[model samples]
Structure formats: C-alpha cells, structure tokens
Target: MSRQFAILGLGYFGSTVARELKRHQNQVLGVDRDETRVDALSDMLDHAVIADLTDENALKELSLEAYDAVVIDVDDDLETSVICTLHVKELGAKEIWAKAHSDAHYKLLKRLGADRVIYPEYDVGVRVAESLNYHAMVDFIRLGERQFIVELVTTQRLVDNCASVANLSIDRDALFLVAIKRGQEVIRNPADDTPLQPDDSLILMGDLQALREIGRQI
Candidate 1:
C-alpha cells in the first residue's frame, strides 16, 4: 500500500529519501528553508514547499498531521532538527524518523518522540568495516543487541566443503541458516537438503560472534 510522507529539510539525505519514496509511488511532501533545494525537488515530489519547519505556524500550514510518516533531516543545525522533530511529533505524525549527528543528538531526538533515529555516518562506517573484515559478507542487519541477519557471498572453497545445508555443521544454538540467494532466485527458509553453490549468497540469522566464526570457516 502507498503511504504519505513529509520530509523536512531537503538536504542530501532528506532529498534522497524523498526521491526514492516518490519513485516507489508514495506520496511525498518535501519541505526545506532553501528555495533552491525545494525547487530542485519540485518536479519529483508530490509537493515541495519552502518553509521553516521549526515554525509551528509554517508546520501547521502543511497539515503534517495527515502524513503517515515524517523524516527530519536537518544537518549541521542540531537545534533546528530537534525543534522540527518536536513540532512534527506534536502535529501527530504517526511515525517520525530523525537523523542524528552524535550520541547526544540521538538521545535528544528519541526523547522528543522520534520513532527512529538514524546515525548515517556511523552506520555506514560499521557496514564498511564489516565488509572489509569479511570479504564475502555482502550486508548485515542488526536484529537486536547481539543478533543479526547477515548476507554472505559463498566462495568456491565453501561450496566444495559443504555440498548442502545438511553437510554444514555449526552450533544451531547460536546460528541459523535462513535463506540462500542465487542470481535472481531467492530460496527462503531453505531446507537442509538445499544444495550449496559457489557465488551464492547465504542469509543467516545468529549471534554476532557466531556469525563471525561462520564467516571465518566459510
């Protein structure tokens, strides 16, 4: 189903989200104090407005409460970001996602009622480090404090060693093979009989340490 989103502060991060959401056929309203930024995205979003998000009257004009979700992405100006987030929350936006520059900013946003706080730089850094550490790890999603869903690219050595899911033995208490992706095909909840192939991608859910151990063995 399509959803309506209001993105405040049309900087790089906010504009990117607006464009992608618009591309996906969702209704997106892009707001920015800079006319140039709003104009640049005018053709892409459902509505592009040049307004100060921190101003309650300006926010009221947008009828932000009708938006299913609102994203606050004001960079550099932490005050503006927090104020915008608080205003959006008061406007009754169902979900609010805010970008935080630091730990303190993150906590403040959370306290202001941001449903999700994103630390883009830190997250990207962690992903880069993971990919660098494990050459075969394509991506990872943190499910909890210690659990993660990891996507690892299979190697010829791994395929030769483990012919099928049943052939690979690991601590089930710590790791679980969730799925396998080969080319465009995705095998979800693959059975033990599922054959392993070189260059295939394995999606596994498990503890971080256990995942690291599996990465080494593979």
Candidate 2:
C-alpha cells in the first residue's frame, strides 16, 4: 500500500532515502533549504521544494500531520536537526525518523520525540566490518542486544567427507539451524540427515558471540 512521507533534507543521505521511498511507490515530499539539491531530486519525488525546516511556521505550512511519517536529515547542522525534530513532533507527525551524528545528538533526538534515531555511517561501518571478519557470512540481522540471525555459506571445512546436518554437532543452547538453501531450493526445518553441499547457504539464529565463534571456525 502507498503511504505519505516527507523528507526534511536534501543531502546525500536524505536524497537517497527519498528516491528509495518513491521507488517503493510512496508519496514523498522532499524539502530542503538548498534549491539546487531540491531541483536535482524534483523529478524523482512526488514534490520537491526549497523550504527552511528550522522555521516552525514554514514547516507547519507543509501540513506534516497529514503525512504518515517524516524524516529529519539535517545532521550537518545539529541545532537545525533537533529543532526540526521538535517542530515535527509539535506538528503532530505520527512517526519521526531523525539522523544523529553523535551520542549526544542521539540522546537529544530521543528526548525530543524522534520515534527512531538513525546512525547511517555507524550502521554501514559495522556491517562492512562484520562481513570482512566473517569470510562465510552472507548477511545477518540483529534481533536484540546479543542475538542475531545469520546466513552463511557452507565452507570447505564443514563440507569435508560429504557431511550432513547430523555432523554439525552444533551446541543447541548456542545456535539453531533454521533452514538451508541449496541452489534454487530452500529446505526449512531440514532433517538431520539432510546432505550438506559445499555451496549451501545455512540460516541460523543464535547469540552474537556464538555466531561469531562459528563464523570463525567455518
């Protein structure tokens, strides 16, 4: 279903988000103080305009309450960032996602009623570092502070001698095998006797420490 959204900045991060939202068929209003940035993304968004988000009166004119959510991405200007967050909150925006550049900025955004605080650079850096550290890790999702669901390819070390799921000897308390992807086929709740191929993808869930241990071993 299509939803209404408003992006309150037009920098690299903001423009990228606006374009992706529009690509997913959402109605996006892209606002920015920079006319050049606004014009550059005008063709991609539902409405692109040059507006100063720091001015509550100017923001009120946008009728932010009507949009399903608003994203505040003026991280370059810390004061403007928090001010916009406050304005959107007061304007009755249902959901607010704000970018924070530092720990203090995150706390301020949270105290000011931002529904979610995003640290784009930190998020990307962590994912990249994890991929580099875990050679077999394909992707992963953090479920909580210490828990994660990871996808890993069966490495040569684990596939030796035509091993099967029964040969894994995984610690039940640490990790649970959820599924296996062999070529185009996906095996959910796979049997212990299921044959493991060298290139098969394993979907497993466990604590991060346990996952990291397995990642290092295979």
Q: Candidate 2 — which residues are off by over 4 angstroms?
A: none
Q: Which residue pairs does candidate 1 place in steric collision?
A: none
Work out the TM-score per prediction. 0.96, 0.91
RMSDs, each prediction? 1.2, 1.8
**lDDT of model 2 at position 121:** 76
For candidate 2, write residues 1-218 as lDDT tens digits.
Answer: 99999999988889899999999999999999999999999888889989998999999999999999999899479989988999899999999999999888998999999999998777778888998999788889888999999999988778884488887857779899999999999999899999898889999999888888778767
| TM-score of candidate 1 on Cα atoms, chains taken together | 0.96
Alpha-carbon runs more than 4 Å astray in model 1? none
